[model samples]
Target: MDFDHIAEKKQEQKATVWLNLWSNRSPELLSMQLAKKHRPGETVSACLWKSGAFNICYRVRYKDGPDVILRFAALGRAILRREKVQNEVPEVFGSGICWAGPYIVMSFLEGMPLSQLLKDPSREGRPVLNPQISNRSLKRAYREMAMLILELSKHEFNSIGALEENKRGIFIARRPLTFNMNELMVSANLPEKQRDSVSSEEDCRKKFTARCLFLNITKELCAEHSQGPFRLYCDDFRPSNVLIDLSTSRVSGVIDWEFTYAAPAEFTYVAPWWLLLQSPEDWESDLNQFLIRYFPRLRTFLEVLCNYENKLIEQQLLSESQRLSPRMEHSMETGLFWVCLAARYSSMFDEIYWTFIDSQYYGTFTSLDDRIQLLDQEQQHEMNELVKLKTDQSTEGKESFTDHYPIDKLLEL
Candidate 1:
């Protein structure tokens, strides 16, 4: 199929999945699933709540207390893995596969997504700060975010990975399940090709060739102190994943810890990418143009972050040695933020590295071929093979989304 056909099929697949999720939401089913947390037969009303890329959430309301959010993983797999990181995440009442779908029941938090408050439709074509948000509200929101970052940074773990409950119900270090990896495995239909997976040596080489380079380069460049005592890092900790009270300009709750893991301290030290409501790699404008708009908001955030750092120190909640604002400022100034962003998001790595990172370290090159010349023989061979494989995958038969999409109706699933 052509590009337009592929795009159309992908949209059809998305709509079908949504329809399945929507049709499955019966009051009886919702009540049955939620019975473990609340009293049964409370005359609950279920409504289509919200839909995200990976899950669909339903708002089930009863006469008393806050509404319950019943979420189903649309892809027929468990999205919520056990992770023990202390944050403002809501209490999970129950989670299991019910007739409606693979679900997780949690107490609904009352607040709009921070993304809604930060969005400025007018800013779509421009490189500028969000004009909708007032200076006062923006600063208040920044202060709360800085505090959240500071609080999370205090909790440190020895290993750089995710926390999972053992048979004894204790949280232990496990292989980190990063957001980028999840997207690759799910959206790209790529099989699990981690270092220890049973996948063939060739498959692992194709996946990890670029990844190894990123690790080596980051290790060579990143500060020695930022390497150890990994801190809790949530890849989805953007504005959309956070719930904020618009009236008070405060963060009420943080949700979607599916991508949370204990990662290098540099992940925490780099200023968040969501301040501008867009990823730099995905920015519509040129990198220089995006930075022109991004740096102003980044400056405001760093200022507020520094102030929070001082306050935490005064309260004895944070040590002077542990202050992270300076390191964050340095990350932006030295372009380490782009480095970290590229490290996590492989899809955007080529653009980000060629656009922002490569020039800073190895000086500007005219093309990717010139950059590849710098790599040794084995690395170059692996990169070439990986590139060819990805190119073939883009045009292949069943692996192509257009051929494999779920064009069937909701009931068919």
Candidate 2:
């Protein structure tokens, strides 16, 4: 896929943050002009908005027709077009882009975000209506969430890349796999000498090629046993992106369609981050307390997810396609999803890799000096490089906090 577009390119600052700040500090006159250009003969009834960390939103209503919401990506638009066909997301009203910022207008869909719906609404910015989500109320909500994922994962494409359209049609794998591999290589925590060697673009490109080959091989290992074909998926398939109807406890619509891609079935098969309504990296200071509650819920979630997959298989939904493989299945089992994410998000590499992920590939060993004696010479060579990386990390500093890896049998080969 278009590797150039993958988020590894270096920039001066957080472009999204800059854009957001600029939009806030600057006048809205230009934004209004943009809206006017897109929808001629319509009055700008209101400029309602909720500014997010990266994007700034505005609710613009037309006097004669339905209202639409305008959203801007401070970093700039990633993919060029709006995929209007995906019903789970808001309808794309139109877009108005300029040097200042990039913006798109979408039809205003009702219903509160699932996050607000599930939690206490008495708090500020909670959904106006609170749906009962006690231990009893969670099943319907969870099942609907699971079902949405199952249905959405059905749209498949031949290649592995970001979703984009061409003369042919709306294709999931149409875009090039454009993530910054250079950044990943830099994340290895190498000795200063080894790090200096990779200063040139050629070196980075070589590492990029190697990384891609590694990922391809890993993906194939999972693909051999998968039941479904590779398909388009939202990278951020969390609760915050989902809207739910309070009365029925059903998913009203799943928004945040940007950055969706046709990835390996293995990627989608992995458990989502929102399963516990918290992220591994940012759960809280009281991590142990959180996981005590989270693990049981996670087990039930996996049970429901797997059960749904089985039902799909029984009904022959996966007749021609592949199913979730053991490798992808181990995502939750090993928390390897975090590792997978680290490929592109290199900054998190040392923490995730050394803390937990390294054991999966290297087999059980005491330290960098310890040997498993199981891998072949070439595999051992790779392990040595990894060991050096780990050693460098240790030399730099120890992990600030410690906890057991959350799941079972993750350290085993």
The top-ranked prediction according to lDDT is 1
- Best prediction by TM-score: 1
lDDT per residue as tens, model 1, 1-413 = 01234333454566576556657666446554574454343535777676565566777776765667866666422222222222113576667555544567777788887767667757654233466678777887678777778877887777777666547752535677777765544344343121122134444343444355556678787757464777878887777777887677778888877677788888888978878866544576467777787788888898888888888789887899888888888997787898888878765675576678766776765654555556689887776676555555544454434323233422123
Give the Cα-based TM-score of candidate 2 against the true structure.
0.65
Clashing pairs in 1: none
Measured with C-alpha atoms, the lDDT of residue 107 in candidate 1 is 76
Candidates' TM-scores? 0.78, 0.65
Backbone clashes in candidate 2 total 16
In model 2, what lDDT does residue 247 have? 72
> Where does model 2 exceed 4 Å of error?
1-28, 75-90, 120-133, 172-229, 284-291, 306-345, 371-413
| Per-residue lDDT over 251-300 for candidate 2, one digit per residue giving the tens place of the 0 to 100 score | 77776665566765666766665655544445544544655766666666
In model 2, where is the ten-residue run with the lowest total lDDT? Answer: 404-413
Error of 1 at 201 (Å): 22
